[model samples]
Target: MTQDAPRRPGRRQAMALGAGLLTAGALPARAIPAADVQPPRYALERGARLRVLRPAKFIDPDEAIFNENTKRFTDRTGIEVRVDYVNWPDMPVQVAVAYNTGQGADVVIGFGADPHLYADKVADMTDLAEYLGAKYGGWFDLAQVYGKKFRTNQWLGLPMGGTTSPVVYRRSWVKEAGFDRIPNDLGQFLELCRGLKRIGRPCGFALSHAPGDAPAYANWLLWSHGASLTDEEGKVTLDTPQTARALDYARAMQETMVAGTMSWNGASNNRAFVAGEIGLTQNGVSIYYSAKTSSDPAQNAVAADTEHAEMPYGAATKAPETALTLNAMVPRYTRVPNAAKEYLRFMMEAEQYDRWLTGCLGYWSQPLKSYAESAVWSSDPKLAVYKDAMDTPFYEGYRGPISAAAGAVLENWVVVDMFARVATGQQRPADSMREAQRAAQRWYRG
Candidate 1:
């Protein structure tokens, strides 16, 4: 079956992949309103159709839950929902074309931080916030960056699921290398990597893609080193000496990463790590689900042997902050704004939230702090390791407007290419960062 094929069977198989069953006890306690509670006026009518577009690869369980819940929504309210899965590479262009032409699905997913750049094309979600606040008991805190909310407040997008970048490694390999545990400090981490390499087992660090994975790693390293990409005034200030140190360390790590990663995109890097060819890599935890379930057993070799931890920290900074990422929005063009708001509210409830997370097979973080802190995460031995990592997670500025300038910086291929050049030794880290900083300043100024 194709990757996007109906995953009912796969869901069942995945349920059986581990011993932890979806227990009734796992459900949250809050009571949803009775049927008599007046439904939103814009709720879909019986057989009404809604169009959705999202990336193809990440479709698995989230799509399944979304379709199933949507069917239930239709059944309860008499509306039909239709969804279309697009390849990740095609989604941005498709969204761009559709938005420019005034034609596109009612909902789209997988843009990541790019929506800030496409704000004009996508609907502003701010108008729906009051409705969401009333329904979902206030909006997500992380959704509002720097006092302005992106989708509704600033009116850009809404969150579907929350996620963070984490360090994934093979526990067994680390144990064999004489390291008792994953390193928390930068010095220890580098020592661990060198030790692993000296034994002919090179460690893997993700530095792939121009803006996607590479920048994510670079940002993480910057944080790890106690540096900020932008200060309170929203200026481009990544050229500081501290940031320079972080970039220098990243370049060194890039040199030791598994061969060919410079050409690898996000998925390729994950595949190489899962295949046991690399010792460690920084990436989203979603790869854990994919690695475990891949048809080729070798592709999942590290699944059973691996463990997760918070992203490593710098010697100077004990803990670094990262973004609480999500995909969400209230479209300005939505015909049924109230209905969309209602759906967004429902999506965040504990019951629906559980279904979405499980259905996605644990690709992203649970948005509710209660869910992450509860037994749902801790009781599962495999996932418990991640709980500590979530406690101190970081996000972009909560008070500032989503930086259209920063978003553009991320989209520039030239900037990414320059970073790659430094990583591969084609240029010095300072020179490459200076070139990229100049480009970012130009974008910010323009």
Candidate 2:
């Protein structure tokens, strides 16, 4: 559908695809509490219309959840909401073009590390954020960092919820490898890959220039090894001994991974897994759902064996894969601040938010701390593993601000390419580190 741009997640839907754009469509500073924050004093503007662009409802069977939500929102407040869907890959360029041309949606679904890039182009929603946090709960560290003005702490977007990523794999294969559950320790996880490889079923990891998969893999690997892209002081620390060690781990990982992983995109690993080409890989739950919905019973059987686990932790474990932290922002050029603000506020209420989350299936996990204990997770075995990962996720540019520089580094896939060089034997682990260090330094220096 995204003939224009099918970007990798979100990893936009954490199901990476690239082809086109359909008008489609974050946690915030915080969520919940219709009573906690006083709705702004201004009356809802009658006939106020809004256009919101986002990725398609990948988690839902269709966009009906949003269509219904839109209908209800308009019904409750006379505002006409025009929604469009865009393919994830095309979103960054299209959204930027919209902003640059002063022609854009009143409200938009921005990805994990986007607010900083559009901070000035979008309106500050400090009041709305404060109200939500006060009424619902305090903002998580990742939410606070990604949603606010990095230097000013001024609200630039409403903390909408985001997608949670997981290592979706075959349960039986893992069991056969002498593990009762998915590996929770890094060492065992790699050994599991070795075991799988020996049995003619290797694991797959994206080593390509995937906007979604690349960063997700890099950050997860780096963080687990107790390393980071940058330090808290915002310096590029990718060249450290710790980072070199992470690279070494990746190179070793390649031995057990399919060689073609160096060229895989967001969907490559999923395709491989469902096709029975690979036994393990990281992805959102969509992969499992994909198998569950297949018309083929064999595929359904694949779904039966399919399961998920959060990435195994490491000495440096602090966050999960860069889960899609979907946030909503209003462009500065919007004509209806009040409407946009109210639209955002309406979404945070428990009834609407919870329902929307359900409609999205388990693809979305809540960012609000209070929702952490929700039965949505308790209700199913497949979904329960995600709750902790969602609660503990760190934003893409961990130990650093989500800024233009960091965004540039990610969009360019410097980290992935760096790891690829080592995995593909294009460079030594140390040389790959030096190369990525130079690339990151150029961006940080700017």
Candidate 3:
């Protein structure tokens, strides 16, 4: 397996890039609360200000638009909103420091699993469900996480945008390699990779042993073989035979991957693909969008030739894992909790949602089932790939009260270490997975 050179900048450099690229606009006007409602119950007064803290980098283009949209809200509602962009690497530390210093923002955005880490700091959203339900025509679909319905009252966070890991390939390159269609199984995928490699171009993947992308690749393998990290009772379950087989398949395929992939993080993977060093890869749809719109000419290699397909399958199952999702929440300590709720409500409005989705540079998948089925997406050729993929998408199991903390630990450290070991050949796939299971057990027990 090829090792990627260590080119990732320090956390401070990432933060500096975010600070430079981030642009904040004037706050928008606040929505007026109706009379007979408690003054402090549903909405902020016309000039109320809300402070929001989130990762500073623009991984998802929708965030930048969301920042601008928040200003529009302020413009309309006479509310003042301030967004603090913290780098992903520094987010945990910054959040902890802020909360410790009593300086946490009214709203905080991070991974869907983050709320569990700071559950005590987030407000229970039960009361707002009634209002959201009445406004949106029904209850929000928290059930997508697990098979059962979640109590909306206890749901402290709302999904900001949804995402899925898909196989993004170079249509031209794959076709040139004599593949008429993207492979459907691991064997065919590897065969295609080997074919591409012979021609001096290699298939690539975002298999970095880092937060966010590591578990993504792991889930791709686990779900492809019908395995899951947790069973219905919420116990760790990564040591099964199916999981082992899947890992074995991955290890074999690793030999066919592009050079330098082992060290490439999410951003680097995108960069490599856009630079035309790799012929195919699996990742979130957002990367495809960035490549298509990048100002740098060398990074737009697949701009007009890329295609999105459902993740490849394993020997046993035809279905892929559920798409990754990110959520938004209001903190319990916000002086403007009502305002924050109203902001969430505003975000879900059809017009605003469209802007948020489109602005995200195709990173976001529709959250509401009804929205996914709407004519707007069905008719758009550019978005049809995602629409088709969502037909049978799956989500993580055990998406209950522990979703936040559990997800954080799994994505941030456990999965990262697993990939690092496997990619570097320091441990066998089964051994790495067993270690990962131990890590998960320790986290769950905590």
Candidate 4:
């Protein structure tokens, strides 16, 4: 894997490349002659109507965009594709129920590590995955790990793409607090939090049962501090000094944050920021999308000043930021596996995927490395930070294979609850880590 390669950018190094390549989106695309890739195709024997179930993206705009883009697909191929957008947290459960009942979402959005959980039920896409992988440079490590099974090389879905959870903050508030730059390390981040509090614009990472943001922040901190959900053997390994250290830092950060963060869900931090209640939070660029689209002048101003930066790294330079991968899995029961594969191939094409990510406003990062050459990031400097996010994210099951066990841990909120306990003073950092270790071991044993 390129992950362990020395050439891959480390923490500060990635930031440097990030700042330098901030204009990479301005670079022109160059396509040399290469081998032909037979596009995925299907006969008219299968029904034209394809039903897809997907969770919302960056305020659920992905649904409309996918619907709009498929118009071109339908126009060209005469396939009627309908994408049904559901709540982010509810997506997995809904798909599971539908698929188990002999019904199927021709394509299901694999969030919360859904791909690994249903690998056997989903159609094998090894040929398609390899085609796209070779066609588009290579798949991101998380993409490969998430879509494929644990030990074998079986692929259950197309590694459609992932979302990078970077630190989204208000530049004006940071400058108002007397800092010209966002924090680059944990110590600086804490100080920045103190300054934001001083300026009456406290920042917070939602600690509630936020389906996305809460667990995202928890994993970011843990991985940054060199803690992980499991060891290489896929055993529970979260109760370490590194984990305690992360918890301590989170506790100190909690002291500087807004009071109501503990009760919040995924949308809370975004809403808080849009309402001008917080100065910073860890999220995709959805906050910018909301602020920019809002009719209120104040909201527009917040959008104007909003910027994205890397999550502050811990003392170790090996920190791997977390990401969410959306695998497009076609159920085994679906007769239109070829059609579903075609839809995936369509979305990953240069023109189609570029517009999709742009329409999502950088909320979704591409699994294909070549997609980085798109001009969307350079079109606006704010979206540029996320350009490197998906490129360097650690999957949910760090240092271990992606498995149902990992999904159970994540779905049960073991890590999120661990951090929430520390932040809410429900348990001492070490105590919380110990309890969480026990809780996680139960899943690991299964």
The candidate maximizing TM-score is: 4
Q: Rank the candidates by TM-score, best first.
A: 4, 2, 1, 3
| lDDT of candidate 2 over 24-143, digit per residue (tens) | 112222333445356556466566898888766554432555666677888888888988987667678877887789877988876766767776788888888877777666666556
State candidate 2's TM-score.
0.88
Q: How high a TM-score does candidate 3 get?
A: 0.81
- Report residue 264 deviation for candidate 3 (angstroms): 1.3
Worst 10 residues of 1 by lDDT: 1-10
lDDT of each: 0.58, 0.71, 0.61, 0.74
Task: List TM-score per model, in order.
Answer: 0.83, 0.88, 0.81, 0.89
Q: What stretches of model 2 exceed 4 Å from their correct place?
A: 1-37, 42-46, 317-320
Clashes of each: 32, 34, 17, 1
Q: Please rank every candidate by lDDT, starting with the best.
A: 4, 2, 3, 1
Error of 4 at 442 (Å): 1.6
| Candidate 3 residue runs with Cα over 4 Å from true position | 1-47, 57-64, 98-102, 133-153, 294-301, 315-318, 373-382, 388-393, 396-405
Alpha carbon lDDT at 259, candidate 3: 83
Q: How far is candidate 2 from the true structure (C-alpha RMSD, Å)?
A: 5.9
The better-scoring model by lDDT among 2 and 4 is: 4
